[model samples]
Target: MLKFLKIFCASMIASALAFSVAAKEPECTFSATEVYERIADNIVKIISFSIDQHRVLERVRPGIGSGIEIEPGLILTNYHVVQGAKLIGASTNDWAFEAQFLGGDPVLDLALLRVPFYERNFVAPEFGAYNDLDVGQRAYVLGYPLGVGLTLSEGLVSGLDRQIPLNTLSWTTRYIQTDAAVSPGSSGGALLDDCGRIIGLVSMISSHPQAENMGYALPIDSIMPLVGEIEEKGYVSRPWHGLYGQMMTPLIATLLLTDPASVPEGFMVETVEPGSAAEKIGIKGGFLPVMWGFSEILIGGDVITHVNGQPIRSREDALKTVGALEVGDVISLTVWRDGVSLELQAELEERRNFESDLWVNGQR
Candidate 1:
């Protein structure tokens, strides 16, 4: 009888431990209606109007997208929403105001606006770190789709750190992929986490006609640095070195006839714009194009190892290092060329329409 009692006690203990663990787990399910009620007032419908050169009203475009007031008198939305708009207006549940476009980063599809006269209490969205998010975590999207009033959709983070091209801007950007239902009028809405914090800004949806619930958002973390720049200068004066390159990998190192383990990973220069900082500093672009396993990569160019004393392992590392520099700041780049390592210095210039210039030049 004592043996049987001991076995029963063991079973009871296991059951209690399991129950404790289950109780300690966080509740993943949340009411969409409750979330909408809590944040609906924070979301605003953006109306953009196109005006002619004579300043006459041309056309009224309603429901361009939704925006959020990130601070008192400050609004955040997508750049494309107000790309060519002459007049921008925003409306909350009970208030309407005119907003002035302060600045935008087309590469990131982020725009900052100022509601100069708005004095009422505005919701300052709490931003959450993208790094803290995990795949399969619940995500909620709030916006106006198809010109319909405020709508909320729920989904999971399908992917992260996805690279997508923005054909409108002739550039590409990183995005957080989600299965949330987003439509034409959802471009500038907010992607909230389970705690109702802003984690990303809704950007685009899949182009496939049959695609459903495939949407992408610009992660807030990536745009935080640019926000500060826009606030201070009214625009982002992004610094540029005038070079195009790709991050070097082990296979690239092998193709260059260098030991993959011996060479430090960095950007391998492919094209250096003529008369730019890179060319002025004697940086060479690739001389020949070669195919390695069906991927064509330009060979015989300098491999950048470091920027401003920081080791660059990826494109993000190089961009971050450059983005922090002011125009006219001299940046030092360590490069590997002809089996010899050398340090080169270049003064950053204010970035212009480099992409368009490249495209125009390619046609010639």
Candidate 2:
């Protein structure tokens, strides 16, 4: 009887423990007021200063932006905010702290700053499950807009995996689109979920008057992995092969006014960045430029038939294969040049900066 009693007591205790654990988990949903109250202190104001030693100082009005505290003493902001700044600072209503630029990636528009002595008193934010998020979910934006005080705005997620073009170069990082009202200074702010967890980093807003209220943010899920690498090495080591082009199709041949049979179906090499792996492998780019739709395409370059052993039929396939590669990895390419098939091999290298190269269609 005593043995049975003990076993029953143990079962009851286990049930109670399970209930306790479940009760400790915070609710997945939170009200707007609850979210603001929870994460208000996590948002910060960024000050960017451009110093000229030659000029006598009158009054230096710094550029204003927003940032979010990712960890104690570590703040994350847009790279453009502090891109060429001589000095940077982070501020709250009470305390102003001098910030040091730790490391950043221009392509991702992410920068990490460190406030040497400041320690956060509030609880660290939990990252929202980005994969679980769906369209029409509640999205709250917290930032210092127009150099004014901290503001909170709420809206629904309008879209996901949005690929917005940045000048001549296409933004490789897909952004999350929200209807939340973000302004000039709202860059580098936090885009929070209903549970007060960060899901995206507010980057830019639609500048066109017709497209008002459209704000885009970098997915926090993508940035989180790069954040660790930046913390470790001061920058993201993105692999660079320096081959930029579009996939040759029947439509392209039609647009080029060439016979479809003569132009092979493969990745058409447009321009290879100088000193890149593609150039090292003796790959050639097109010399004849033709207007295809809104964009210009070169017609006389080598067509990549295969990479390693896999067929290169679409641009997506090439991107997937190259994106999986790391620096120093060897790659073999099969190219068709003037009715001759040539096999070439090269090792990948690290991409440091492509901001200046963007004007020349430098995307790899």
Candidate 3:
């Protein structure tokens, strides 16, 4: 009788442990149809009326884009969509609500808007880990294209940590590249996982006729850090280096008429923004434009070898080193220019809304 009771207790304990382990595992994976059905209501149509710069008489130009609700009444979209908007509105098929600009970060091309009143108790979707996503994993894009009804397109993740130049400026940030079909009105839409969790925000696409199914999204991890600041402070105060350039390579050295071994590998400084910290420290922009393959590159600029005594080797390395800086922090740069090496120092300052200005002026 004693042995029988002991065996019975052991069996019960094993069953309980098995049940606990199973309960801890995630099981939210849904079918493709279910993902769309669940997320469609949260996807919204963004309409904006802004001043037209091209017209001699300033006229209100209407624009349409897509938005994703991150909270009860908070919408997140691309900053370029409503940069100089006189008025902005968001709507679903059921109801329309007026939206006010909460804040924006032009550097990241992200903006947050607030809706004063909402009809239903909206539940925001969960966010997935962007790092865990494999290159060939399934990805879905949900948005309104050309003011048509909400659409869903499925594709696979093409690449990661891509540095594509969107608009006129080459933004020094990471973008997740996918083969998903993104269109004119798809900006600010959500790149979702199988469980209907947002992994990225659709930002831009390669519209060249030759380029097919090339779309890019900003990873959600990059935006998570700025959410609180953007909500409270109205703008993300980014640490400004205010310098733009390409990474120096052996090919770039050859184009610049220099020996590959003679030129050090680093971030090649092409231009310094006017009135920027780099400008204050006497950094110079390139004047001579030479064709490097299909792109035009300037040669006579400073090649940054190190930042704050940290060796700058790759674009990722440079961004990682400088990205840790904050405004009011003093930074030091070691650059090689005109066959000479120089050390420059400057106190970091706020980057102006130059990107917004360029967009509003129709330069991009």
Candidate 4:
């Protein structure tokens, strides 16, 4: 076995060009030529933060984060990037310098950072838009997937008009669908188009058994605003809504839209917990019923229409419209009840209280 391995090793080295193990990277693995230029040209190392001490030791501490030099010293990354660190990078000649975070938005997972004035300008990566993206479009992911460094993978858009789960005190939701090839450390990375104009930010991947390639990206529409806001306020200003729900399909849509011979779009109430933001505002939910198969097995409840003045055409629309709001906001809702459409006004409520009422822990 040992002799056979040596022969194989000699063959590999001889075939490739007798490369020195100490001087060169592995022949089979990703090569320097594939990345060194890109890394040298684009990749910025994410430096973990060191403890801050002494309020008086002030000497202009630099904040460092991984970034793609969009236009010279102008870098772009997730807000969480330079959250508490200094930005540092290397020059074309391999000379390193410290950069600073100009601004950022945690809500959108995008940020703008600036490198100190240097002799040579850095080339910016292309930004693409998803306005023309279709459900079946071939999507390519370019970023440090798995924190492994610049890598590329391909997958279908799989879906669109997707609303991610809300787990915050403020209502915040956006359109995102699952795709394969996204993983941890990919967050804040670009989910690019073939032209790479910056379609979305790879934000999260799913954790469900049925969810492979169930990754979500913050759409460009939502991310661009964050880039500007972070520049103005050093943070993102998110909107608010009181209701939370899963998307309704055509079947679910029928129940929410109307039962009569006429009506088009809306959402069926899947599960509305008691005393929720929706409940507090007089939203209705279904009563218990036996699961007997039938034409309209979907239980009746509040069929949501417009939230904060936006129409809820489907379950995904309802979630995204409502998730983008903050607490204490007042929103007007158009609901369908018993085949009739009605308008109602509501004020946003804290989710923690509602969650507490949900799990019986008294705290959420």
Candidate 5:
């Protein structure tokens, strides 16, 4: 009888313990297996091709690209994936759903796509904060690598604030660096955090013989807000700020810093093109290019310290502040001039739609 009593008592304790555990919130993780499942559910094969062959072979020789499913049916891929797609007449027309160009810029090498559910439905991949990413940190690379299937690779961030070329007038600017194995088929894949949220998009790699594992990915800081623009306007357009920034160094740190420096730091402004948005907004830009260490760097303009009441801590943050608003969206600023800070408001204007894919006859 004593043994029976003990067993019943233990059973009651176990039940209480189980209930307590169930009542607590769950913990997040960065698991390889779990990340793949997210990719499996989110990644789709982008088949781009010309229909001229569809008529001949009764099927098109579809080119493959990786895409992350954002909102149900909405996928994000590189604009190059759909380059000349409309001209080639790649399309969809059905009753359950359909898709059309939403917003993108071939110059930026970025594109936004929507798929209708009932009208179209799909998951908007969770986004991670790029501000949290540190140089030399470990991160996961997820995507349909080689246009095969969902896969993950591990690498350390090796670079920051890079400019990559896409076309004569187009370039992806201010990107994060990673040493992960990237391939042509990996374009538009997700560079995710441990919790399986996207922090960047695996986009480009250098084919130089002397190049190591250097590759670049566009930061999530640039992508998070784009979701809203595509949804509301079916497109997005904005003018280049037309200013180059340097971070505050221990030397320049004496000057109020508010931007990012890619190397041993000190802040400066350079490359403000005449008549650019930065000019119209009255932001001071550097007049001459200077040399630092072995790098010929641009320097000497007014340093920006804040925007819209937000303290400018890095180049990415400042870009985010301006990039988040529309072309006509107004943004205010506080800048440091020779150590004296001043404030101003600039109604943002459009000089180039760097984020739009709207084109015809291969021209905007």
Candidate 6:
């Protein structure tokens, strides 16, 4: 009888442990249909209207894409989708409304629109933490592909921290690369994680006609700052230091005649705008052009070690540091020059019309 009692107690304990483990396990896996059902109401179809060069009211050809409701009556989409649009209309599964173009960030390919006095309440998607996402994680793309109805496609996070060139603006920006099938009409759709949280907005796919399943999305974190700016100021004014550089590697350091092990990693300055903050502060740009592998790079410029006491480790780090500053704010840079290290200070300037400025400055 005593042995039987002991056996029953062990069985109960084991069952309790099993239940606890099951409770602790995460519910990361989810069904596609369930995700669509939850978010379909917030997904919208955007249509643009404008006048043609012939001075007639014209429906812009292929002026359709997808948008996500970020706030009540406010939707987010791609700038290209609404560019030159005189009138905009948005529709969901059950309702349709006229949308007003609030503002846009062309560089980031983001546009904000509002459906004023919208009667129905909107469910804003929960933004997933971008930094927490990893490659190979399951992802879903929801949009109106090729002017069809709302569609959902599944893929994985194929890459991260990708810098792709925006051919329309002739500038490059970071993107979240995925293998999700995104087509022309799918631009500005939601790229959702397994939890149905939006991690990115579908931007574009590989330009090659034969490229299959290669799509990219603009990470939501990179757009939040611009969104806040647009919400408050109606536009984004990024702080500029008039400096451009490449992240330093061991090979780059050796090519510059520096001991790779001795100096800390940083960005090697390649260009400085004339009469700009960098030039005013005596920050030298590269003088000699050297062929590094297949690419030609400028050498003999200062290696930036820190910005405002924060270590400058990558191009993203430098951009983030400068972007956080307001116009007229002073920033300090610790640089390596002529085999010596020194710190310099410069005031930030507002960068307006970056594309025109890039053209004027002869920067690619």
Stretches of candidate 5 exceeding 4 Å from the true structure: 1-31, 49-64, 87-99, 105-108, 116-124, 132-138, 157-174, 206-209, 247-267, 279-296, 299-347, 354-364
> Could you tell me which 10 consecutive residues in candidate 5 have the lowest summed lDDT?
1-10
**Could you tell me every candidate's TM-score relative to the true structure?**
0.74, 0.77, 0.86, 0.57, 0.60, 0.76
Worst 10 residues of 1 by lDDT: 1-10
Selected candidate, larger lDDT, 3 vs 4: 3
Per-residue alpha-carbon lDDT of candidate 2 for residues 1-364, written as tens digits (9 for 90 to 100): 0000011121223323432111222346577899998888889999898765566864454677899988887899888778768889899785788899999987777889998645446578878866777767778999998888999998877667565444212324566878888887898899988889899999877543234466878888888888878877888896677776667888767765668888777888888778888888889998898854334567788899988988888766776787688898998889998879889999998876766522223321
What lDDT score belongs to each candidate, Candidate 1 first? 0.69, 0.74, 0.75, 0.51, 0.56, 0.72
How does candidate 4 score on lDDT? 0.51
Model 3, residue 31: displacement in angstroms?
A: 2.4
Candidate that scores best on lDDT: 3
| Candidate 6 lDDT by residue in tens digits, 32-106 | 888787788888899887656764554354378889988888889987788768888998878888888888876
Residue 227 local lDDT, model 3: 84
Across 192-235, the per-residue lDDT of candidate 3 in tens digits comes to: 87778888988777544345566778898888889889999989
**Runs with alpha carbons beyond 4 Å of true place in candidate 3:** 1-29, 53-58, 117-119, 166-171, 355-364
Model 5: per-residue lDDT, tens digit, 1-364?
A: 0000011122223223432111112125546677656655666556566455436565544455666666666777777666546421212222222346677655456667666555443356778776676665666777665566556787766555565433222222566767777766677777866567787877666554434555567787777577677656755566555555555455443333434332222224555545766677777776555444223444557766776788766655655665566667667777776657778777655655433322322322
What is the per-residue lDDT of model 4 for residues 1-364, given as tens digits with 9 covering 90 to 100?
0000011121222323522222222222433343233434655544434335655566445432334555666666655444545433422234456556676644344567666656765566645555666655555555564445566666656556553333332123454554548655555555655344456766555453333455667676666645655667766554433343333445444444455445446655544545556666677766534232211132566667676678777545754655566767888888877668888887766443222211111210
Q: How close is candidate 4 to the true structure, as a TM-score?
A: 0.57
| TM-score for candidate 5 | 0.60
lDDT-best of 2 and 5: 2
Candidate 2 lDDT score relative to the true structure: 0.74
By TM-score, highest first, what's the ranking? 3, 2, 6, 1, 5, 4
Q: How close is candidate 1 to the true structure, as a TM-score?
A: 0.74
Global lDDT of model 3: 0.75
